[model samples]
Target: MDPILDDHLHLDPVKGRGVEAAEEFADHGGTHLLVLNKPSWHYDVAVEAGDDFRVAYDHTLDVVADSTEVLPGRAWPVLGVHPALVSQLVERGYDPEDARDLMCAGLDVAAEYVEEGRALALKSGRPHYDVSEAVWAASNEVMRHAFALGADLGCAVQLHAEGSEDFTEVADWAEEAGMARERVVKHYSTGGVVGPTPSVLADKDELERVVERDVPFMMETDFIDDPDRPGAVLGPKTVPRRTRWLREEGYDEALERAHVETPRLVYGIDTLGTLA
Candidate 1:
């Protein structure tokens, strides 16, 4: 089996399948994962300050440890303030500026985890939907803060923003923050997005289209592991399942790039590394 990896996933021991979901992915041939924290609200955290994010980040780290215990270092954690948290903070009574500041503070906490080696990446981005201009501006500010943290830590920043083929501004921000543009990955990528390196969704058609490019890319299930939604975003097994189909279709070289090579380059971790 190849070193299949899901670039973005979330586990909720409280509200989702959590570690059990890791078993499913492993059963289907997935060898590793880049597991990110769900939104702050998902953990019942109301952000009054950056420290509020720790409640969620700690849980995510715990989940990572537990999943790794089962999969033997197959899981690494990415901690951050989700883009939607800005609005959630606002709706929950935070002034816009306060909400933005709190989000930045949240990223600071996440960066500490990365510096301490408890996590490998920081996640941040503007909301993907329409919003008031002020809110949008604030979200961008928080994202910039995340890039700065990534630069300081020399770690990757996983971005979750509106879907687009281009991310020129995001590249500019990453460069300004002293983070390599390639280190900024676009989560939920549409197979062939431009600018940041893509973590393309593990769709058969999408993977097939991007594999031929032979660029730095990885495939992901983006599995939320929410029992309520069952397979929201994508399921735990999707990446491995799609990878198997791709292999049978004779994409060995490209699959190696996606499965092993790209992950090593982008995350500074070898394919399943010592994890497997």
Candidate 2:
């Protein structure tokens, strides 16, 4: 069987089940996972200026690196600042302006990690639709900065915005930031949204449409690693199961493109580097 890669997932101790989750994913045929850092309280404080953020960023790298002990070459790291946390900070009494500043600073740290080979990509994007326009705008600004930074560092930027059928706005943002549309990935991408930009889809029917369009995409459970909600968005084993289903349905070519080829092209993962 060809190895299945999960493009987006969290494996942190705070909100995720960490190493145990990694073991479970591996047990279920998940070969490689792009472990993203969530905007937990420690991370929020770590994004602040000074040596604190740097230390936090380094710790993030350490945590991701440690996942390899449980899954070997299957673990890869994606570091970034989540934009939704801006609203959380505002609710906690932090000034909006200060929150924006911290977000930008966090992106800078994430870009540095990409440059240092500590991570393969950076994740940042707008919050949900219900957030205040001011918060949304501030998050967009941060995303712009992140796009620019990713462009400069030759890294892909995964966007965590609301699900939208049209990605023209995000493509425009990438263009305005002088970044390549191909380097901009839409995270938590569902069947509803379709485009050329790389994305990770959860639904098989939607995955079929994306493949039919010849879109560059991958599969993800967006597994948050929450023990209480275990497999909240989708189970850790979901992608692998979907891959098997596609194979059975005779969509071998599509599965190969989405599960094997696209990840290698976007994240530069050699087949030999994946877990056996």
Candidate 3:
């Protein structure tokens, strides 16, 4: 069987089971994973500045190194500053411009990791709701900077944005940033948007829409690995199990498109090989 690729997950040590979660995913038939950096608090980037940004950036690289030790070729790292963290900084007395600068600096660090092949992609986007307009606009600037950096580094940028039926704004931002729309993955997608491929959660109903559209996209459990919430979005085993279910139900074409072809096309990852 071709390996199932999970496009979005978190291997946070403090809130999550970390390597244990990866092992569980493997046991369930998942072979490739894109693990995003843990939230900003893990490195205190929102509350501090200067060297703190470097420390926070380094922490994500450390996660990539450690996750590789556990999952080897199967685990790939995605580094970036989430928009929620940007909002947090703004609320904590950070000027919006400074916050944007901090996010850009973090993206620069992530770009280095990508250049070195220590990471596979960059993540940046604003939340769907709860952020002030000013904060959202500022966060968009941060995301634009990330898009440019990703373009320069030849890496894909996975976006975390508000749930919406239309993604015209995201596509516009990508264009304005001089990045290709194909390189921007809309994470946590509900399978509603038409343009700019998305990485959506595992849901049979949503999968129906995705298959109907025949769009380029991928599936993710968005597994947070939180011990307290324990599979808050979905369990580590969810994607593999869903892939099995889809295959059994004769959705082989859709399964292969999302689990294999699209990921390789978008992220330039070949999960069949071992990581160096």
Best by lDDT: 1
Better of 2 and 3 by lDDT: 3
How would you order the candidates by lDDT, starting with the best? 1, 3, 2
Residue by residue across 191-268, what tens digits does model 3's lDDT show? 776556788789878877787888887999998776768777989889888888888888889887887778778887
Off by over 4 Å in 2: 42-47, 50-59, 195-198, 272-276
Which wins on TM-score, candidate 2 or candidate 3? 3
Which ten contiguous residues of candidate 3 have the minimum total lDDT? 43-52
Residue-level lDDT tens digits of model 2 in 1-276: 467777887776554577777777778776778888766464446344523456545655676766677663567778788777798768877777778888888788778778988789888888866877778778888888888897788778888887676788777778777776767778887654644255666677777777677667888878776667766888777888888887888888877777667776766676445655
Tens digit per residue, CA lDDT, model 1, 134-235: 999999999999988889899999999998878977888899989999899999998778789899998878887788777888888888877778898989
Q: Which portions of model 3 miss their true places by more than 4 Å? A: 43-47, 54-59, 69-73, 273-276
Indicate which candidate wins on TM-score: 1
Per-prediction backbone clash count:
0, 0, 1
**lDDT (Cα atoms) of all candidates against the true structure:** 0.86, 0.74, 0.78
- TM-score of decoy 3: 0.91
Clash pairs, candidate 3, are 128-162
**What TM value does model 1 have?**
0.96
